[model samples]
Target: MAQFYSAKRRVTTRQIITVTVNDLDPFGQGVARHNGKALFIAGALPGEQAEVTVTEDKRNFAQAVVKRRLSDSSERVAPRCRHFGVCGGCQQQHASVELQQQAKSRALARMMGTRDAPREVDEIIADNPWGYRRRARLSLNFHLKSQTLQMGFRKASDKELVNIHQCPVLAPQLEALLEPLRQCLSELKAVRRLGHVELVLADSGPLMVLRHLSPLENGDRQKLEQFSQTTGVALFLAPDSETLEAPGNVAPWYHSDGLRLSFSPRDFIQVNDAVNQQMVARAIDWLDIQPTDRVLDLFCGMGNFTLPLAKRAASVVGVEGVAALVAKGEYNARHNSLKNVTFFHENLEEDVTRHPWAALGFDKILLDPARAGAPGVMQHVINLAPQRVVYVSCNPTTLARDSEALLSAGYQIRRLAMLDMFPHTGHLESMALFERI
Candidate 1:
């Protein structure tokens, strides 16, 4: 189907339009208007005048990026990362951390409130702003024209590869391998057959998973092992038939709140260690589990909170949509020797009220759904009659939508806090506690 667009007038591409940024959107884009239609300009801050080029013209709105800044905002700060504008890994780096937190805090408050006046906000939970990311996915751009492999990140605006020498956001040990991996890949004849690579800094050490379309020769395998031995990066190659190429290794585990969690190489884990720790601590405290309580955890990945809740509650049942995560959750429970905790495989988005697991009454419930939010199951939450519910969210817009559903079902928000998980990015992580009226 062809796309229909709304515009004040037909505008040609690459047309330069001077506009004053009125405010910032959740994506860090500057919001403005031209001829009554909304225009989004990237890299332009509020209270600044910028000359932007129209990149995409759409119905009701258009996308653009600032070509030149004519005026500056008082909150703008120098970005710490040299590749800030190009790498696309980090956004809102030019703004002060204080302003970024304030923006996110107010956004959440506005979503939670009945009026425009800023809702009363508790202090934000924060940690070190830099070197917080523990896991990174680097791209493999095999250029046939130049016969070179660009092992780095893509540009913020497009799929064009931007070769990185170092990334300031990644942990120190992982950042040091940026150039080394590039050099190592350059010598491989199978470089073009390589897929994207995932580099992770686990509590045990650094691990690398290389997805390959073709097999690596014996010589190449030896070279990779040597690279691993020299750099101490546990390298595993997928799609290889032999276990020798990809070591059959146990899941890497991280300890938090007296519980040990083991996750697969590809399993999701919080990238910011410090903030994740605090987030877990807050969840456990807010839930106020009791020895006679049976708690239900929705979207519980790898038992991050299930095991901790198990220590206080009579029993904790963790439900995950992904079998891999459920398996890891079971493994983590065994690794931690928590007999009161159990994991079940079920899609949280589907109706599961009849599932035998749901037959058990839950005194309190905790939800840590993905960015899409857990709207499908929210309408049925009242059936369980949980006394309290703690919601952990990554997206504010979705959280607001779900909160309304819970409110209509007789739940009142008791406590809320904004977690500064990604300090320099235009991302928001919030935790709220709601009680049945």
Candidate 2:
């Protein structure tokens, strides 16, 4: 065992230390303590002893990389993807899914003040851990010396790209096209001009969007179109950042609660479709919507929750920051023949209490804010004084910070669940139901 000692930053000297990991943080880093400071070790797990080298030293905590894992935890498992360590897409693949969820729940419990308290995660919503990603964005790089094209995810914590031959996490329909798509892009005359590619598996069919820096040659266009026809993948080209051109009329849409929502290629749809469906259902159930209840949904995108809530409530008002999405939400309401739901475009970061929709009393409120969280809107939400509020968050840190206002306003947590939206990854998504006390 190595000695525990504090040292100043050195230019050449190296020090190795042995530490016993006591716990796993929510982001999957192993937690250890030495000399009254926490040490976060990478590639280590709870109940494991690791020989590690401190990479960065700070006052409260230190970061280290394991030189050798002296002991392994029972939760450790072989990763399915060959590029597991190299690719930055996933962090917790070495740990079992059950362990991952447990760590996440513990972290969430601590964040929500339910760890040693009465409130705890009521349920953990999860699905097939592998092959669940319905959408993916792949980076492209053209090597000058080899005269070849490399396509895949980025390297872990680095800008270099890892050439992926296969990805097990992608939906089977989209994963099957990886090799063929790579071959097709390599053969294109404008291969050097390719920027990146995005693959999405919709209920209707698979769709591909090629981001190219320069105009494609006529022959290259024909080749892409041919590839699309052969593979039955709808093809779209992005000549610039803002525009998307489809060779064929392709309107991609996915099924949610028996409603059809049409979306453009670049729209923000849930990466895990199965979890999204279950999440929507659970959100509705936890809200306990009644026929007489009028609900307000903040940060609503294309009626994912708005239209679904409309099914249970008397009226649902959807507010979105993006005008395009608000327009699409209205279109989807009309498409679904849902007359009670209305969509309004408003900047949620500002004071929205003065908005016309804000004036009307709502029995229930639901918010699905982005990673930044609803900074300026949380207090406003408290002012509305709805009977129930369900907050769906992608970032737990922000969720905890924003929950202060609601908790202070006498809103007690009625239910909480951990949404395993992205498995084998450090991203934690959760939902909390708060009822006025």
Clash counts for all predictions? 1, 0
For candidate 1, write residues 175-214 as lDDT tens digits.
8888888788778878889877888888878888887788
Q: Please name the candidate that would achieve the greatest lDDT relative to the true structure.
A: 2
lDDT of 1 at 171: 88
Candidate 2: Cα lDDT at 138: 96
lDDT (CA) for every model shown? Answer: 0.84, 0.92
Worst 10-residue lDDT window for candidate 1 reads 241-250
Q: What's the CA error at residue 335 for candidate 1, in Å?
A: 1.9
lDDT measured at residue 84 in model 2 versus the true structure, 0 to 100: 91
TM-scores of all predicted structures: 0.90, 0.96
Which ranges in model 2 have alpha carbons more than 4 Å from their true place? 1-10, 114-119
Q: Deviation in angstroms for 359 in model 2? A: 0.3
Displacement of the residue 275 alpha carbon in candidate 1, Å:
1.1
